[model samples]
Target: MRSIRLTRMDWRDPAFAAGLTLFLVIGTPLVPRGQGIEIQLDPLGYTLLIVSGLTLAFRRVAPTAVLAVTSLATIVYYYFAYPGFFQPSAALVSLYTVAALGARWTALVSGAALCAGLLLISFRPAGLPDRQAFDGPLWVGGWFAAVIVAAETARQRKAYLNEVEQRAVDALRTKEEAAKLRATEERLRIARELHDSLTHAISLVNAQINVAAHLFDRDPDRSRTALFAVKDASKQAMGELRSALEVLRHDDEPERPHSLRQLPDLVKASEQQGVAVKVTVSGDSPAVSQHVDLAAYRIVQESLTNAARHSRASTVSVDVRYDYDKVTVRIEDDGEADSSSVVREGVGIRGMRERVAALGGEFEVGPRPTRGFAVKAVLPLGRSEDDNGGTA
Candidate 1:
């Protein structure tokens, strides 16, 4: 692709040189000149003019070389007193090309050499006036100076256009990076929600299944209650699944976001799983932002699920404290752990830790010094909407 682009550029320069050469060849004879004695057009004069015009095709690639060749040829043609004079169009173009290409010193030095060489011509071409000498050189130098200023202007404008294009590219790259990061964070959030909801709901369903199978013959009423509990757990799991999948719907409809306000329902679900739960709240939950609220509730749910599934604790205690600057959560169980066995962190425990840490909270989970297991977290508040996907 790059070579093709360069080839195209090469084609354009030759076309431009052809136009200027054709103009120099035809326009010289047609344009009227003042009354001055002149020698007829000869083969050598044509050679000089043609040589200068040909050099212009390489102006962009070798501006200084083209400038030197054309400037020398134009001075030689006029100094020998050709029939009519022609403009140094090729030389002028080469000088402009150098400046426009941002080679400032090369343009200036090459232009100075061109003007100086032309000035030395005394216009002694078959008895020409000395005053014509001054006028011709002055006009050429003036035109060269004007070309330099114009080239500088064009170069500055091109530079500005390049800068604007670069800025646009940078902004687009930054936006793409931000979108990728957001997608990764969103995937993590969805995973945590799924783990918490499914683990807790499935634990209740499994426990009820065991109860219903065991009591079907001995206690029909209790067995029916366990079956009803299984149905409710499945229904609640469906609702939670829908809620977690709401983002894919891309709607303005409200969401059933989890919060500490729903702890009673969470506790009842765990109790149904055969683990007694006691929840204590120290501060009002209304002041907590929804992100923090969702995180806190998921932490509690994960804690309860781990207790019922791993610890097999008969009783669990949950404490939530909302203070001036932060909220604290502590869950402990009474089930005794084996002294020789090592406790491993499952997906539920890791998900709980991630949830708290994402909210800038600190989390810890391990066997207690005296008894069973404990999970505690401290989540600071006052995060802005922009920080948490426009949720306060």
Candidate 2:
């Protein structure tokens, strides 16, 4: 019961209590009959005032009904020459309610009705004196117009506020969707990087383990060398994996740039896997854009990994040439005539192609005319100026 009381128009609402008090005070006959003002009430006059004031208790609930009932009662009182000002004020309250919540046509019709009713009273035999006829209707009509205007303004203001809130909600939803898309792209990039970095090293380690197992009894020294190679490959693979993961864990930490500087270590890793690799770099190593440098490194890494896994080549040669405007990388192997077919254009080849193409570079991989496979990439060079003040 207490909860229901709180939900309804209880005494806790200041507006509800205030409206009731105001109507009662103004509707009662308090003015004395002097100075051209009179308060002479028959039984009908007393009833009209009390009913008009009491109906205000439900003004918000049934505004149109209260207006109709109070207006009729007041009209009857005026027709019989009752002396009071309460009923007219009550009618004005009803007019405001209709303007605020009712349709435009309905409020306009109600306004017209009040104007016509007041005009009839003004022209009646017991109506206002000749001196007040002009000023009386003007003042009353102006006050009614003001009430309607105020109600319309409040309605428009409420609509404008609702529209503004909806726009803010839509903008926030768009921002959240964009953030999720970015997170998804970042995850895919990390997966691709991890796959390219580890597959070759792990493959080499597996080969060394097989070699050691085969030679264990026949040649203990040769077996020991193979075992050492396995350990080295395993450690190197772990170090590279940790580097990739550290970049993922702390995004703010700068990534170590992979370039020609790491080429010697890469060649040595392949050599341990029983492939003799010859590396040659002609011309100076010029500073290039970060993306270009990284693309170049990844292309070489993928090519070496593929050659080690597929080509039965005893000798592989890598030659890098740095021109004024571009850097060219070429890897060749004297393997079987079908060595190129061994390295299919799968995920590893596709990744290298994408990396080079994204930086506006050229990439090619195919079989040599005589015997062997060759992978070549030509990457464009740019001034190494990063967003940070230092060189890229």
Maximum-lDDT candidate? 1
Query: Poorest 10 consecutive residues of model 1 by lDDT?
Result: 1-10
Residue 239, model 2: lDDT of: 78
lDDT of 1 by residue, 87-130 (tens): 58788887888778777677777777767776676545554477
| Predicted structure 2, TM vs. truth | 0.66
- CA lDDT scores, all candidates in order: 0.79, 0.73
Candidate 2 error regions (>4 Å): 1-26, 31-113, 134-137, 156-160, 219-222, 248-251, 274-286, 310-392
Best by TM-score: 1
Candidate 2 C-alpha lDDT tens digits along 64-136: 6877877787667666666645556666676676666644455566666766776677678766677765454
Candidates' RMSD to native:
4.4, 7.0
